[model samples]
Target chain A: MVGIVVVSHSERAAEGISEIAAEMAGDTRIEPVGGDGQGGIGTVPDAIEAAIDAAAGGDEGGDAGDLDPVVVLVDLGSAVMNADVAVELSDAEATIADAPVLEGAVNAAVAATDPSATVESVREQAEAARDVDKL
Target chain B: MTEDGAAAVAAVAAVAERIEAERDHLTELDSAIGDADHGGNMARGWAAAAEAARDLDDPDTGTVAKTVGKTLMSEVGGASGPLFGGSLVFAAAELDGGVDAETAVAFAETYLEKVEDRGDARVGDQTMVDALTPAVHTFKKSIETDDLPPIEALAKAVDAAERGVAFTVPIRARKGRASYLGWRSVGHQDPGATSTLFILEELLAVAADRLGVDAPETDATSPTIPDEDPDEGASEDD
Candidate 1:
């Protein structure tokens, strides 16, 4: 199973979205990081990096070893920029999904929760949401 | 600390002070064309950068530069964080040990290139590039043609940057949040360009201090006190 990291400019938005996605997350790790540290509306690269660490289970002295690849989903503008920079700095195997944050996270949660889901499969399902009809 | 390294820190500290003082003004400018956070973001970023520079443990100039970049990237939010922060990181990669006239010229040139590549902005985009491009070109030209002392060359660069900032007032933005305004973005100075000019002015001040010459005070901006010579066992601020 792949892990999911949700990045939004608003801290509450990221956490709320993570919570929604978690309903379908099963055993997969889903972490949320957002907002400038000062309670402002902006994303922080350091926060994103920390979320990636938690998703990959790297904070407990070492990798939990059972962790899967992590995927990041970002909202507009600097969220994407900061996330890209964070991923580069972390030197991790994480990839940012190009899908919409809410829709992608929901689809990704379901895909990643499956025991057979690989990082690629999770990303595919997440991205495929773009074509899903929503009446 | 080497002479050049100490001078570099002084330059960044000067920028931090200037940004802090002008923060509200910068925000006012941004409010007209973009999000009003540019001022706050730059102020916080420079504060972190100044702290990093002050606390450097006699490291090489390159390490100091890298630390500044990393700190800004981590501390600053919004588009300027990555663009300005990435520029410093790239410049640090280009810099070696002690700073010299040629190395400073190289830093400006490389910084300009990195910003262009990262932002995909041009000279007329009403972005930071509008100011930085001219300043860098002026710096490089002064170094190549007249082989002027570092202070004089940097003065020209600062002058060019100021002119660039002024030129942004009437141009419609083509990039960043300001671009969303289309023609409405005209008639206001770009916050990024103004800040870029401030940074160049501080750099020129550093050059003048290093050469022990009084920089020409063409504008009302106050001059910064030069750091004590490295032999003086660091300044009180250190």
Candidate 2:
């Protein structure tokens, strides 16, 4: 199954994004990771890497599939950079979508549930949110 | 010269010491245009990196660098974490076979490439790329073209990085946190550039000490093209 990971600078933001994304995520795994691992507001590569690892696995307690493809959605600045590092350092196949966090997560979550979903397809869906118009 | 695990650890230790000592200065530079956490973040990261490198068991130079980079990527809580530490981690592979004149150039080039790619900043952006580009270019040319000893090449690279740091002082910020300042960022020295220069200087000093050679005097404006020596550690730049 295609997986989606959401990364933000705030732990709360990441969880909140995940919560919203889960509404459309179906049975697909959605992992949320953020924060500096302390009481501060920032992102860490280790945290992001772990999130990718988690998202790359099968549901709740199922056997972890090795090298499961994963698509990651990230917020601005260091969040994106950290995700890039995590993708490079992670063993699982992962790619970070260059799109807005919340909208991209929701889009990615939905796209990942499709039977034909691939990491690239899900990433494309997530990046498609970049041109989302609120008007 | 192939740096053993122990030598790489020593270099990391020296860099950590220098960064710790200059923490306040770096923060001051950042305060004028950035979030003022560069000092604390870098000091904390490098300290942890030194410790991590020391903990490795009979590791190679590449292992030491990768360890230090991973430590920094986690500890330095800002764009610098990826820009500095993450880039190092990505570039550590260049040193896996060992460090020599050719491998060193490749490592420098790869490190510079990663930093630029991560930050999306070029030479005139008044970011760390300003310092790194000149340093790597100088190191490559000095070693491959001028046939200088690695120690002397490092000295020249440090000089180039020093100049790059100075160049950042008068330029308007075009990238990173400082870019938010607009024209106000002009006049303040870039903290990242300054820190990059400091790291290169420490590397040069450690390399000189390791090679048991005098710290060569070098000027960015004038590189000494010494007489040809055949035994230099030159390898094909494939």
How accurate locally is residue B113 in candidate 1, as Cα lDDT from 0 to 100? 86
| Off by more than 4 A, model 2 | A58-66, B1-3, B224-238
Superposed Cα RMSD, model 2: 6.4
lDDT of 2 by residue, B1-238 (tens): 2356778889899999999999999999999998899999999999999999888888899988888988999999899999889989888999988878888899899999999898888999999999899889988998998998888888888888888899998999999889999999999899998999999888888878877887888652345432234245244332
Query: What do the candidate models score in CA lDDT, each in turn?
Result: 0.83, 0.88
Specify the highest-lDDT model's number.
2
lDDT of 1 by residue, B12-115 (tens): 89999999999999999999998798999899999999999999988677887888888888787798988888678878876784577778888888889878
DockQ of each: 0.45, 0.76
Q: What's each prediction's clash count?
A: 0, 0
Candidate 1 versus the native: TM-score?
A: 0.83
Please, what are the lDDT tens digits per residue for candidate 2 over residues A2-92? 8889898999999999999999999988998988999789999988888998888833455444557999998888888999999887878
Tell me what TM-score chain B of candidate 1 gets against the true chain B.
Answer: 0.88
Best by TM-score: 2
